[model samples]
Target: MLQELVLDVRKALESSRPQRQADSSFDRIKSSFACQFSSVNPRAFLPWGFVRHRTSKWIWTNEVTQPGGDAPIGARAFRKDFTPPLGKTPAQADIIMTVDNGLTLYVNGGQVGTGGDFRFAEHFCVALRPCLNVFAVTGLNAGVPLACLPPSKSHTPTAPPPLSFPTPLGAIPLRWTPAIAQGAYGVAPWGQITIPSTTPVLSLTAANWIWTSEVVNGNAPAGARYFRRTYYPPTGQTVTSATVIIVADDAYSLTVNGVPVGSGTDFHIAQTYTVNLAPAPYVVFAVVATNGGTVNNPAGLLVAVEIMSQCNCISGAYFISDGSWKFNTGTSVGFELPGFDDSKWPAAVIEGP
Candidate 1:
C-alpha cells in the first residue's frame, strides 16, 4: 500500500508537536500579531491594517481669514533638516505627533513648541528615543480678517489709542528702608526711597519704586550703570498721563532727571514705556540698574510710575498702612494692601482673563 502510507504520515507529524508547545498561551496576546511577530527586524514590522499618509501642506488662508490669524504659512524660510526617523530611543520607542492649526514647532531650527489660538485644533508630542530627531513647523494668521475670502486684500487699519487715566491723583507710601542719606529723609543711600511729589500733579510719582545695588568692597562697576531722577509736578500738576514700567530680571536703563526715558537690554516682564510730558510741575524719574553685577546673582530693581488723572478718586484703593487691601503691585509685594477697586479690577486682571 505504499509502505503503509509512509508510516501513517510519520505518526501524524509527531502528534502536532506537543499540541504546538502547549498552545504557548499565545505569548500573552497583545494582538497586532504580537507586534507583527515580535519584530526581529522585518523592517521593524508595521503592518496590521496599516494605512499611514502623513502629509503637511502649509499655506493656509486664501483669504477667508479669522480662525487663528497671524498670516504667513510654510516656507517663510525655515527647514534645516526636519528630522524624524529613529525607532527606539526616547527611552525605547513609541512616538507620536500631531499638528493642524497654525502650527509652530521647531527643534533644530530652534523654537521647540507653541500652541494654537482661537478655540482649539493643534496637537503636539515629544519623546523620540533621546537623539536623532528634528522637526519643523510654522504657520501664522496674525489676527485674520480678509472679508470672507476672494483673493485677499483689505488690510490697513491701525487703531490703538484708548488708555487714558487722568485725575488730580495722589497716592504715596512706597517705602523700602536702608537708604538714609541724612536720616528721616536727608542723607539717603541704603536702598529704596520715594516720597516727594505733591501739587496739581496729574501723574508725578506714585507708581511705586524699589531698586537695590551693592559691591562696596570690590569697587563696584562690573556691567550695568545708568541712573536719573527729577520731579517737580505741583503747580497744577500736568503730566496728563505717563507710564514707565519694569519688572527687571536681567538688564536695565531708564531716565527722566536727565532725559533718555527708556532703555532695556533684556529686562523681562512688566514692560510698558510711554512718555510725552510737557505740562511739567517737576518730572524726573530715573533708573540705572546692574544689580546682577559681580557676575549676576540676586541684585534688584522693581519700578513703576503710572500717572494719568484729572480728579481725586475715580475709584482707587491699594492701602497698606496696616489696613490691608490690594489690587495689583504684583500682589501687594510683601504686605501693603489697598489695591483692588479700579472699578472691580479684572481686565483679565491685568493682561489675561
Candidate 2:
C-alpha cells in the first residue's frame, strides 16, 4: 500500500510540471509578438495595414535634417518663395509639395491643401500667379515613441529595374509610334543613342571670331552688359538659313532685329541659335551678357555667325564678327531694334589673339 501511494504522488507532480511549462511558453510567444509589432523607426517593418501606395514621385529636399528628441512632436513650419516664368497662364502652371510625415501647402498666402499620415506623401496642384509665389509647409512627426525594431526579411522590397522609369501613364498619346510606345515602359536598351532627325544648318569654327567684353579686359563686371553689331545684307541674296554659335562666361540672351531668338544659362558649353531672316536691308544682332559673379572666373563672349547665301558673291560678306561690335554696361530699352542708338557704348576689347 505504501508503494502505490508513492506512484500516485509522482503522477500528480508530472502533470503539474507540464502545465507550468505551457504557461511559460505562452508568455514567451506573447512577448515576441509585441516586440515585432512595436517599432517607431521609419526603416522598420510596419504592419500591412499601415502601408500605402504613393500617388506621385517623391521629391526629397536636397538638405534633410531630421529633428532630435527634444524637438517638437508636430506642427513645424517651413516657407519658400519662387517666381514663376513670365507670361505663364494659370492653366499652364501648377505647384506640388510634400514632407516627411505631414504638411499643409500654401501659395501666395492662400492655403492650397493639407495632408496627414506618414504612409502617403503630400501632393497638390493649384493655379499659380505669374508673380512671386510664397510657399509654406507645416510638417508633423507622427511617430509613436517606442523601441525601434528591425525590418523583417520577408517584407524587404524587390530589386529595382536597371533603367530609370516613372509611374505608368493612364493613357498614352495617340501620336506615339511603336518604338516610342515601347520606350514609355522603360524597355529601351541601355546606352542606346538617339540620332536627331533635323540636320544642323550651319557649322563653323571660331577661328574668325573674337572673345570680347565691354569691361576691362580679362575682368568680367558683375552685371548685365549689352553687345550689338549691325549686318547689312547684300541685295538679291536669298538667305536660306542663319545660325549663330555663342558662348559666354555666365549667361546671354540673343535677339535679331528686336525679336528674341534664344538664351543660354550654361557657361561651360556653347549654345546654338537659329533664325530665318527675311530679305532685308539690315539685320541687328544683340546679346545681353552677365558675369557669373565668381571671382577669377574668365568672363568673355565668343560668337560665330553662319549664313547660307544663295549668291556666291555674298557668301562671306556680312556673316562675320569683328571689332565692329560695341558694348554698354547695362541693358537699354529697345536695344535690339535696328535703329537703336549705340553711339555712347564703348567698343568691345578683343580678349584673345
Candidate 3:
C-alpha cells in the first residue's frame, strides 16, 4: 500500500510539471505585445479642411474660386507624391484633398479625375499601386467672391479637430490562470475563468480588422472537469441594447443573467461566436464543458477566448477613441459555482444592487 501511494504521488508530480510548463508558455505568448496606440488618431487630416474631389475630365488653365471669399480666381495648380510608410503599406488608404472651389486628380500629370462647385467638404479615394500608380491633382473654378456665390456652397472648408492616429496593425498576446481544485470525491468539477481587468487582455493596433485567440490546456488534473472561458457584456452597460460575443473551444453552453442564450457542440476547436443582450448594468456569462469528451486530447483543457466589436468608420478608424472606450461603457467580471476542482474557483466576484 505504501509503494502504491508513492507511485500515485510520483504520477501527480509528473502531470503537474507539464501543466506548469504550459502555463509559463501561455504567459510568454500572451505577453508578447505591449499595448500602446490607444491615443493615436489616423483621421487627423479630416477636420483640417483636407478632402478629396474626383473630376470627370481634367481642366488646365481654369480659374478657381476661394472658400468663404478667402481668395480670388487664379491659375493655380500643385502636385505631390505620397509614399506610404516603408514596409507598412496597407492594401488601401483614404485620400484627403482640398481646393478653393473645384479640383481634379491626374496620374503622372494626365487628366484622370475632376470635381466642381466646391463648398462644405468633398472626399474620395481610388485604388492604389499594383492596380494603377503615379498620381497628381489640379484645382479649377471660376474665381468668384463668397458673397457673389449662391447661398448654397458646393464645398465647405472647416478646420481639422485634434487628431489621434491608430496604432499600426499587428497580432496581440493573451494569457490567464486555469481553474483547479481538490476534494473528497477525488477531484472537483472545473469552473470557467474570466480575465479580471476591465480592459481587453489585448489591444487594437489597427481598426476594422479581426483577431483570433489560441486556447491551450494548463494545469488540469486527471478526472478534472472540463471548462472554458467566455466574455460577458460589460457591466454597468444597458442590457436592453448591449451586444456581447462569447467564444470557446470544443463544446460550450452559455447563459446571460440565468437566461439560456446559446450552446454548441462543434466549438471544441477555437472559434468566436456572438451574443446580444438587452442593455443592463451587469450581465452574467458562464460556460460548461466535458473533459475527455469530444476533443482528441484529454490531459487538460485550455481555451483562449477573444471578444471584438465592429465599427462603421473607414479603414484604420475606430468609431471610439480607443479599445478602452468600450470597456469603460460596460462592466466585466467572472462568475462561478462550487465545483470539483479548487483551481475551478471563481476568479472574480460580482457585486449586485
Candidate 4:
C-alpha cells in the first residue's frame, strides 16, 4: 500500500514545466515563493490523486434522466475548470464522482483515473496548480439500462488554503479561475470614468525635436528607432486626461500604455492627439519611428505632452521628447510595455524644438 502511494505521488509530482502565466508575469522580481506541501495527504501536485467510492450524477448527451432512457450509445466529453486564488501557497481539492457505464478523468490535461462502475463512487483528492486547472471527463454508455451518473459530485473541498472550482460540464474552453472581471481604472465592470462636461483642451509646446543625435551635429543611421517617455502623477493626484503633439522625420507610430493611438510622418507637421488616462497613476508613451533614408541620413522625433490630473495639469506641467527620453536602435522586445526596463538604453539627444 505504501509503495502504491509512493508511485502515485511520483506520477503526480511529474509535470512539464509550467508555462508563463499572465497579468503579473513580467512584474519586477520583488521576491519568490513556493507551496510548502504538508507531509501528510492529498494536495494539488500534478497528474496524481487518490480514488474512493462516492456517488455522482451522470451527464447524458440526450437527456438520459433514467439509465434506460434512449441516450445514444457513444462517448460524450465534459470539461470544467478551477482556479485557486493568486497567492504564494498551493491548495487542495477533494472531489467525489460516479459513472454509469465508463468514464475517464483528466486533470490539468493529465489522466488521473478511470471508473466503470456506478455502484462505487470515485472520490478524488486533487491538488491544484497555482494558476488555472482543468478537469475533463469522457463518458461512454453501452446502451445499458442502468442508472445514469456523471463524474464528480459538485462539492467545495475543505481548505488549509482554499478551493473554489465550479462544475460547468457543458461549457468548453474552460479556465481554472474566474476571469478578471474588471478593465482599466474608471472602466466597465467597475464604473464609468467621469468625463467633465467641460474638459479643458491641452496643447504641446517648449519641447525640442530629439532622437539619437542632433541633426546638425550628427546623423542617425537608417531603419527604425525606439523612444519612450513616461509620466507619473503627483502623489495623491490622479491624471484625468492628456494631450501631445508628435512629429518625426519620416514616419512613426505612437502608443500609450500599449494601446496604439495615432501616427505621423512629416517632421514639419506635428499632429495633436488626445490621451485619456482617466484617474491615471502613471502613463507611458512609446514611439517607433522609421527612417526610410540611407545610413547617413538624419532622423529626429519631436513630442510635447501635457497631463492633467488637477484642474490645470498641476499648473501646466509638460513632458517633451528630449534627453530624458530613453532610446534604442532597431526593435527591442517588450519595449512598449510599462514594466520593460530601459535603464540600460542611452538618453535621447535634443535636436530642435
Candidate 5:
C-alpha cells in the first residue's frame, strides 16, 4: 500500500500537476477539515445524517474539552499503529490533517508536521518505513473546546488502500480509537476515553463565568460577593429538573429557591448538582462567593445552570453566571428565595473565560 502511495505521488509529479480529486473519501475529508465549520461552505462538506464508513470519525481524549467546555489548558497524546502491506517502502506519501486549535504530528517517533489554525487543513509528505508504522499526535487545546479530526489517508497510485487511522478522544488518562469523535453526536472529544469524573457537564458550554464588578484583573475584593439569578418556568407549566455547575476562586455555597443545593471550595474542579422544582412557577439561584485573603487576590465565580421544563422536554432554559445575575457586597440571608427583591442590586461582572 505504501509502495502504491509512493508510485501514485511519483507519477503525479512525473506528469502534469494532478488535479485534486473529490470522491466519497475526499468528501469526508472536506467535511471535517475543509473549514472551521460545515456552515461556512455548505457544499464543501457532507450533509448531516450522511452515513459514513466507521473507519473515519473525529476522536479525542476525555480531558480535551468539547466546544464551550472549559478546562486547565494542556496537551494530550494519541497514537495510531498499523503495519502496511509487506513490500519495498514507499519513497513518499502525502497526507492531510487538521485540528480545532493545534497539533504536533509524529510518525515513528519523529516530528513530521504541525498545524495551529484549524480554519485550513494541512498537507504532509513523508517516507514510509518497511516494518511497523506508527502515527502519533500531540494535541493541544489552549482553552475551552478542542478536538482533532482523524488524520489523513495515504494512497498508492495502483493500490488506493488507506494507510493510517483510528482517531478519538479518550475519557481516561490516555485513549485511542478509530474515528470516535463523529460530528453528529455533539462530537464527543478524545475518542472513547471517557473519564466522567473529569468530564465537565455538556450544558456548561453554553454558559459563562461571572462575578461582581469588584473583580478587577482577576483580583476581587477580599471578602464575600453575593450573586442571584432567577428563571421562570414556561407559562402554565412547571419545571421538574435543574442541573447546575459552580466554581469559585476560593469558596461557594449554592441554593435553589432558598433551599441548599451544594457548595465547593477548590475552583480548579467544578462541582455539579441537581435540584427538584416540580411545582414551582419560578426559580431563583443564589451563591455566596468568598475570596479568602488578607488583600486583593485572584477571585471570580463561574456557574452554568440548565433546566428542562415540563411542557416540552426538548425545550431547556439555561442560566450562566453573567451580567443578568444581580450581586450584593453585603449579606442577605434569604437572597435565594423566589420572591426576593433584587431589582435594586447591580448586575454581576463578567470575568474572562
Candidate 6:
C-alpha cells in the first residue's frame, strides 16, 4: 500500500509539470524583458468594458443604474494597481483607453492621457518603473443627452436622456464583425445564466478580436454549426500559456487538439477558457456552435485566443477570428484533423455595421 501511495504521489507530481514549466517560462520571459513586453492595454482584446456597476452589470456604456458619490450624475473614477515583475526599468511604456464623456489617466501619480471629444478613443504610451505601479482611470459620464432633441414650439423639452445608442467609442473591438451565416434560429434550450458565464475572464487581454461565421448575412441558421482553425507555434519557442474568450448566441464548445478546454451555454456574457498546454509543433482549434430559438433570435460567435510563448508572441502569429478561418455548417468527417483538406469549406463571412 505504501508503494502504491508513493507511485500515486509521483504520478500526481508528474501531471503538474506542464503547468509548472509554463509558469516558469513566463517568469523567465518577464525577467528577460524587464516588463518592456507587458501589454499596454491589457483589456483591449476583450469583448466587454472595464467599469462594472452594481446596476448596469457587464454590458458596456449602458445606463448607470446606481450612480455613486456626491455628484451622482458626474464623472466616476476607477483605479487598478499592479506590481510589474521586478527587473530593469522600462524607458518607455504605453497605454490605450477611452471613456464616454472624457477621462484623465494616471500612472504612478504621473498624468498619462486626458479626456478626448468622446467620439474617438486613442492609445497612450508612457515610461514606467519596474516595481510596484498604480494605473488609474477617471471615467467622465458627461450629463448631456446623446441624441436629445432641442425644444420645439410644438412641445416643451426637458433635460435630454443619456445616450442609449451603442457607440464604438471608449470600448475597443478585439475584432468587430457580424455573424457569417444567416439561418433560422434553432430550438436549443436557453440555459440559466450560471456564475461562470457572468464572470469576466480576469486576466484576458482584450485585443479586439473579430467575430466570424459561415454565413454572409445577419440571419444565421437555427441549428448548430462546426468551425475549426489551426495554429503553428513559432519554432524554437515553448508555449507557456493559452486562453480563449468565446461569446455565442445559443451555445458552443471549444476544443484544442481534440481536448475540450472551454465551452459556453448562456448567450448573455462572454466566457473565458484558460489552460496551460504542453508545447507542440502545431495546435488544432475547433468549435461547435448552435444558434437556437425562434427566427427572431440573432446568432453569432465572437472569439479571441491568446497564446503566450517563451518568445513573447502575444499579438502576432496567434489565431484570431477573421475571414481567413474556414468553416462549414455540414459535417465533413475529419474536418477537425490537422491534415484534413478544407479547400472546399466556405471562408468565414464578415457582415456587420
> Which is the leading candidate under TM-score?
5
| 1 against 4, candidate with superior lDDT | 4
lDDT of each: 0.29, 0.43, 0.26, 0.52, 0.54, 0.43
Pitting candidate 2 against candidate 4, the one with the higher lDDT is 4
TM-score between model 6 and native: 0.39
Error of 1 at 139 (Å): 18
**TM-score, per-candidate, Cα-based:** 0.20, 0.39, 0.24, 0.41, 0.44, 0.39
Clashing residue pairs in candidate 2 (N, C-alpha, C atoms within 3 angstroms):
none
Query: What is the C-alpha lDDT profile of model 5 across 197-275, one tens digit per residue?
Result: 1122434543567777776667777888889988765343366777888888899999998888988989889888877
- List model 2 lDDT by residue over 1-353, tens digit each: 00000000000111111112225766745533343333221222112121121122222221223211122244433334333223221221122222334555444445544443232222233333323334444444454210000110010112321111110111222322111011111111211111111234433342233344534545654777788987653334455556788877688899987889888888678788778887666678899877777454456777766554333222222233456688777658888898999888777776663
Model 1 TM-score (2 dp): 0.20
**lDDT score, candidate 1, position 328:** 20
Candidate 2 local Cα displacement, residue 128, angstroms: 62
Model 6 has a clash total of 28
Can you tell me which runs of candidate 6 are displaced by over 4 Å?
A: 1-217, 294-297, 311-319
Q: Rank the candidates by TM-score, best first.
A: 5, 4, 6, 2, 3, 1
lDDT of 4 by residue, 109-201 (tens): 556555544433343444555444566655555665322222322211122111222222223423222211111222212122111112434
Q: Write the residue-wise lDDT of candidate 3 on 220-302 in tens digits.
A: 22222322222232211122321233332334455545565566555334333344544443334444432334343422112
Candidate 3 clashes: the total is: 54
Off by over 4 Å in 2: 1-204, 207-217, 294-297, 310-320
Please say which candidate is ahead in TM-score: 4 or 5: 5
Candidate 4, residue 181: the lDDT equals: 12
Clashes of each: 50, 0, 54, 13, 26, 28
| CA error at residue 141 for candidate 6, angstroms | 38
